[model samples]
Target: MQQEKESAEEINELWSLYGENRSMEIRNRLVEHYLPLVNIIAGRLAMSLPSHVDRDDLIISGYFGLMDAVDRYDIKRGNKFETYAGIRISGAMKDELRSRDWISVSLRQKIRRYESAVVELEGRLGRSATDEELAERLEMSIEQVHHLERQINAATVIPLGEYMKSEAAIAVDTDPHRSAEYIETRETLAKALDELTEKEKLVVSLYYYDELTMKEISLIMHLSEARICQLHTKAMFKLRGFLANIDGI
Candidate 1:
C-alpha cells in the first residue's frame, strides 16, 4: 500500500515536470523516472500477444509513446501525465501489431464468405453443418472449407480498434442540432486523437474499441490496473484540452 502511494506521488511529480515545458534536464529526469512504468506496460503487452510478436519491439514502441505523451500533455488542466502516456503506449503497441500483417485481405474475404455460408446453413438446417457438408455445398475441399472457417473464427477473436468518428455518419435527419453538434465534437476528438502518441492512441482503441476493462487491459499490457486507469484519465484530459485549444482557434 505504501509502495503504491509512493509510486503515485512519483508519477505526479513527473507530470509536473513534463507539464512545464522545462529544459531537457527536467525532461530527461522525467524519462528516467518513468522507464520502469513504461517497461511494465510493455512487458504486459508482450505476454498478452502471441510468441510471434516481439517483446523487445513492444517495449521500444512504448518508450516512444512515453516521449510523445510528455511532449503533448497539457499542464494547465491538472491532468496526470501517466494517464496520457498509458494511452500513447498502448496505441504504439497496436500500431506495431497492425503492421505485422496477421491477416491478408483475401483471407478476410474468404473468412467472410465462409461465415455467411455458415449462417445461411444454420438458418436452413437449424443445426451446424459438418465440414464435409459445407465443403460439398461450397464446391471446395473439406480441408479448404475448414481452413476458411478457422480464419473466420480467428478474426472474431481479434479485437480491432473502434473508430471515434462522428455519429453524423450514422444519424437520421430528425435531430439537426444534436447531430451537428455530435459531428463537430467527433471531428474535434478525432483530430485530437491524431495528435496523441501512438501508444496513447492504442490505449483509447483498446479501452473504447476493444471494450476491455482496465484490469483486462493491464493484464494484456503487463501493467498494473491502477496504471491503466490513470492512463485513461490522462487521455481524457488531453483530449478535452486539445479540443478546447482547437475550438478556440
Candidate 2:
C-alpha cells in the first residue's frame, strides 16, 4: 500500500509538471510512468494473436497511443488515466495491425464469404447456423469451415471500445450535442448483442470484461481453445453485420 501510494504521488507530480509546462521532458516522464499500461495491453492482445505477429511491434505501436492519451486526457473527467490510456494503446495496436493488412487478401476473401454464408444460412434457418449447416450452404467440408473460422478468429481483433463506443458517445452528449446518430448506433449494437447466444455472451464477457486470456477462458469453459475462437468469431460477425446493415457501410 505504501509503495502504491508513492507511485500514485509520482504520477500526480509528473502530470502536474506536464500540465503546467507542456515540456517534452515532463511529457516523456509521463510516458515512462504509463509505459507499463502499454505493455499490459500489448501482452494481452499478443496472447490471442498469431505467432507471426511480433509482440514488440504491438508495444511499439502502443507507445504512440500512450503519447496521444497523455496529450488529450482531461483530469476533470474523473476517469482513471490508466483506463483511458489502455483504450488508446489497444486501439493504436489494432490500427497498426489493420494498416499492415495483417490478414492476407486470400484469407480476407474467405472470411467475407464465410460471414455472408453464416448470415444467409441463419436468416433462412431462423436460428443460429451450425458449422455443418454453414459448410453445407457454402459447399465446403466441415474441416474447411473450421479452418476458415480459425482464420477469421486470428485475423479479426475487435477492441471493446469499438463495441461500446456508441453508448459511450450517447452518455457524454449534452443537449445541443445530442443527436439521433448516437442513439441509432447504440440501438444497433444492443440488437446485435441481443442476437448472440448465451455461450457467445459468456465468452465475450470473460475475454473483454474479465480480461482473461483465451487459454484461461477455454479452461474455465471446459472447451478447446480452437472452439472458443470459433464462437468468438461467429459472435463478432453477427455484431459486425448488424452495424454494417444499419450504417450501410
Candidate 3:
C-alpha cells in the first residue's frame, strides 16, 4: 500500500464526492489512503514499548482509530485532517497499551516515589538531579536507579504527542482554568520542556513534532534505540512531574 499522503486536491476531490454521495466506496478509499499513517504511528509507538508487545496488534487498534477519524472529521474545522487523525491514531494505540498494562500496582507506587524524589532533589539542588543524587534520595543503589529507569521506560505509555493532545482537550472542557491559570499552564509547560537536556528536547521534537520513528531519530542523533528511549523516558518523567503540579493540567 502506498504510504504517501495524498495531495490536497486529490483528497478534496475524494472528500467532495464522499460528501455529495456518502458512498461506502469513497470512505473506504479514504481509509485506504491513510492506512500508512496508522502504520507510521503504531510503529513509532511500538519502538518505545517492549519487544514482546505485538506491533501488529497496535496497528489493528490504529485501524479503528483511523476509521473513527474519517467518520468524525469535519471539513469545516480548518485543521489538516492528517494532523487530527494522527492524534486520534496515537491516542487509540495508547489506549490499547493501557489495556495491556503489565506493571504491578506496587511498582506504580514505587514509580511515584521515584518521581517525588527527582522533583524534591531537583528543588533542592536547583538543577536536574543526577543519577547518584537520585539514588541517595531514594536510598537505592546506582544500579537500582538504572533498573527504575528501565521500568519507567516500559511503563511509560503516554508519549509527548498523546500528553499534549489530552492536556489541550482538558483545557477546552468548560474552561476549567481562568485566563491567568491558563497562562500559567502554558508557562509551566514551557518550563517543564526547558528542564530536559538539549538532546532530550531534540528527541521530543523529532518524535512528536516530526513524527519520526525511533530508528529515524537514532540515525539522526547517532544513538542506539535503547539510549534514545532512555532520554525519552527521563524527559517524560520531568514533564509529567512538573505538569502534575499544575492546577488545571
| Best prediction by lDDT | 2
Worst 10-residue lDDT window, candidate 2: 165-174
Q: Looking at candidate 2, what is the lDDT of residue 5?
A: 30
Per-candidate count of clashing residue pairs (backbone under 3 Å)? 16, 0, 0
Better of 1 and 2 by lDDT: 2
Per-model TM-score versus the true fold? 0.46, 0.87, 0.78
Question: Which stretches of model 3 miss by more than 4 angstroms?
Answer: 1-8, 164-187, 212-228, 245-249
Poorly placed runs, candidate 1 (over 4 Å): 1-14, 104-110, 114-249
- Judging by TM-score, tell me the better candidate of 1 and 2: 2
| Residue range 1-249, candidate 3, lDDT tens digits | 555677869888988788778888889989998888999888778766778889999999999999888886766545577877887788788788788875679888988898788778878888777778888889999888887787787777774565555444334334545545656766777888987899989998897777777678899999987677767777887888778876433
Candidate 2 residue lDDT tens string, 1-249: 212333787777777777788889878778877788988988878876789999999999999999998997766556677766776788889888878777778987898898889888888988899988988988999988888888788777763345553344334435554557667776777788889999998888787778887789899999999899888898888878778755423
Model 1 weakest 10-residue run by lDDT: 157-166
Question: Candidate 1 residues 1-249, lDDT tens each?
Answer: 113333766767666765665667666666666677678777655544546767788888888887776776665655455655666676776677778866668976775565566556655876445557778778899767655554443343223221242232224234677666657766777787875556557777897666675678888888876556545543553454455543322
Whole-model alpha-carbon lDDT for candidate 3: 0.78
Reference-based lDDT, each prediction: 0.60, 0.78, 0.78
- Give the number of the best model, judged by TM-score: 2
Which is better, 2 or 3, measured by lDDT? 2
